[model samples]
Target chain A: MRRQITGFSNPTVKHLRSLREKKHRKAAGQFMAEGLRLLTDALACGHVPQVLVMGEQRDPHPLLAKLEAAVERTGGEVIETSEEILSKITGKDNPQGVAGVFAEFDTSLAGIDRSAANIWLVAQALRDPGNLGTMLRTGDAVGAGGLILIDDCADPFSVEAVRASMGAVFTQKVAQASWGEFLPWLRSGAGQLVAASLRDAVPYRGAPYAAPCFVLVGNESRGLPEDYEAACDLRVTMPMKGRADSLNAAVAAAVLAYEVLDKVDS
Target chain B: MRRQITGFSNPTVKHLRSLREKKHRKAAGQFMAEGLRLLTDALACGHVPQVLVMGEQRDPHPLLAKLEAAVERTGGEVIETSEEILSKITGKDNPQGVAGVFAEFDTSLAGIDRSAANIWLVAQALRDPGNLGTMLRTGDAVGAGGLILIDDCADPFSVEAVRASMGAVFTQKVAQASWGEFLPWLRSGAGQLVAASLRDAVPYRGAPYAAPCFVLVGNESRGLPEDYEAACDLRVTMPMKGRADSLNAAVAAAVLAYEVLDKVDS
Candidate 1:
């Protein structure tokens, strides 16, 4: 049996709404995942929610029932609330029926399993939440070990990013570190550092992407700075035939990541 | 000398605002291309703006001066407006210093130079403007001949879509058609049709994308309808190793487009 809450001012609803803000999310050490698909992905990825909220659907869908059972099995509270309250929390006119508040997965640079993982993605100063999420999803798709956010990247836990990530947010490990801290790790001879740059680079397809590789992509606008490019073991460029100078950051990342995967497997 | 307009209620400003709406764009057969880079791309692509608007800058950038010269050379009017007016027209706090109102490039299925082109992109019922723009940019990167928008799709001329295109909108030929009208032409020995589908498909890389190929991508949400899949000469799927069921529409398009380009060139 689940509790029913009709009031919008409920403490749980307030907490869920607060998760929308970065400050609150950081303070509470939790983030909100909306929609049945995201919640199911969260659970499948071994992330148990602290709280699950569902809208008042008179006859609950089978998937909803399964999700509810999974929550209960994990000792998480399940609340059946009015659609209005769910919409309020999600800030959408007609929100998805299911939402979950889950503790953020804590990943550290020291915790990454370098021995077992061959490929990694490093995003520097990425600002767009949607692009960050798309990169996370692409990273997961290519079986990258994890993502490292170097200096002032968009919050991966934000609603826009989480939504854009689909379910990859739960599956991919994400770490935050400054360039100064990350440089030592790259120079530690753990792997090859491949940077995507527009200057003095071999074509991406022609580059020999050795195993245990870390592919570095830069900000959407500025790209990888000169010093950062110099630090990389190899630099690769994608061919551009049109007037536009660059591909979208995430698109470039996907193309590079997939190329690396193809070469590695071959 | 360029005309100086300071009033927000000026007819030119009103007309510029109206271009934001689809109805107005369709009626006028024109769209707004904002930002210096996009305007420059438009001019480089041989698209003469009907009107060019520049925000008041104490010292105009050299690029701005060059753009004004080009517009004047093409017998187009250049207007210098206050930043506030520019900002209001664009709905951005700090709008780019330059914008251009250009007539839409009228492309029809009958007008495409299929004989000279090897690759094309076909988007069916794509709803998101950003994804559409990204696809345009990706298509340009791969040197696709043109893009065909099938059935009901978001207006490619929308500001969001154009901005997302990163100025590729000027270089790429875009045509609109219904599915009923497209199938006959597709089967008229025009080209090979390759559709991306998750069902009964080989890996995308394995697909034999022969020359004069039209790579088809479905909508962001529903994907291609079953009958549409059946209509395709070949169906291909991208390998997804993670929990995500599908890649971002734009990312998927980029990956497939590049793969096609690689095979065609080899």
Candidate 2:
């Protein structure tokens, strides 16, 4: 049933506020996604929003109504609330007047067909949420097979990450695991392994690409974990002659992903 | 004069804390930089720290004595304080036990001989500080003639930018100006102008590099301003085959910079 809750003290608003805190997100098994773009992307990707909340002053954006209809088709609930209530719920400087609570995806790497997929990305210890989000968006653009983040990575579901990702978070398949779990694939010879490093790695442009190869990138402040670097079949470095020795994680991911396609096509 | 400030409540510590506020940063025409790497880079570039603070239990790293000696030589003040005081000044979740205040540099285009410099970067409305900082560091590596920032850019001295730049902020010559002030050179044919855009522009690799050129880039969310786009001698687009239509600002800058050098050296 759709309801218009005007007061900030409303129960629905309170529940939305809880989503910002990590503990609550875990407890609810859901997280809040604000803005029409993200919600639309989530819906288009077969993810259903548990509840769709809209501000009374604003009708759903044209595309948003189609998304809401899709949500209802999935037997989800949609509600309208006051702007004040949304402001209180979002804990954001500017509320987008639309927000949704969606189920947290438990995407895992179990039984994935690596040989068929052209390219995959392996992120090692990337700690910044914004960087991770951007990586996901870039991954979506390149039609990546999937993204596997080794332990000690940022939560891609964080608001900052989601915002920076520009809606790619919803479209990509992401899984987080330890280096131990990833070792079997590295040794499988099913694909090539390229590790981006600061020292002694080949230029990224020239790195060889075999089917099902996974490019591993490290943390922003620190390079990849020692164990992960040792696991790579080949190490590659972006040829940097400028003052900065490294590129932003997302940028590196995009460049390498393009290189993968370039090599495969040629 | 160098001094030892013991308590968190010390007046100097309080003043340092105030500098964390943007208003104070602007009012004093100064900024704060943290971590040993940035401090060392600042000193290396002949940019002296006005005040240096270290944790009580902290011994300067391998470069400390040299840094302190250099500080003394430059007529700068040094202070030793408890870790608690350093924490108060930095307000970072994890304090590195080192912090310093340095006079903001205002490198003008006036003294720089643009024609002789040959290579340069113009960041148009880059909103992310980290992107700008990373671009600066990369610019330094490539030996860019200078960095010119358009309006609405992040303060390169902001803590996040400094951390991401990995100390390139101090080494690079940066000039902040509006399009009107910075574009006269391009108009006068002092140098070629190459603008990065998503408009099916010529591939970066094919772009000509005959003389000094300003590689212009825009904000992460927006491409170059219309007027700026119309002014470019050529609009170059990085070859992107994936779903992502574009690259991160810094990464695009790095690729474009490399492409410029590629054309010149070829």
Local error of candidate 2 at residue A102 (angstroms):
1.8
* C-alpha lDDT of all candidate models, in order: 0.86, 0.75
Model 2 chain B scores worst on lDDT over the 10 consecutive residues at: B238-247
Check candidate 2 and list the clashing pairs: A141-B243, A141-B244, A242-B141, A242-B142, A243-B140, A243-B141, A244-B137
Docking class of 1: medium
For model 1, how does the per-residue alpha-carbon lDDT over A1-266 read when each residue is reduced to its tens digit?
A: 68999887889889899999999999999998888878888877888788888888746677677778888998889988988999999887878888889898786777677666667888999998988999999988888878888989999999989988887888888888999989897777678889888888999986899878888899988998899999988999887877767888899989888888887754
Q: How high is the TM-score of chain A in each model?
A: 0.95, 0.91
Q: What's model 1's overall lDDT?
A: 0.86
Global lDDT of model 2: 0.75
What value does DockQ give for candidate 1? 0.78
TM-score of each: 0.94, 0.92
List, residue by residue over B14-105, the lDDT tens digit for candidate 2: 88888877778878878888888778777777777878877778764787777777778878888988777788788876688777788877
Error of 1 at B51 (Å): 2.1
Q: Against the true structure, whose lDDT is highest?
A: 1
After superposing candidate 1 on the true structure, give the runs of residues whose Cα lies further than 4 Å from its correct spot: A8-11, A73-75, B9-11, B73-75
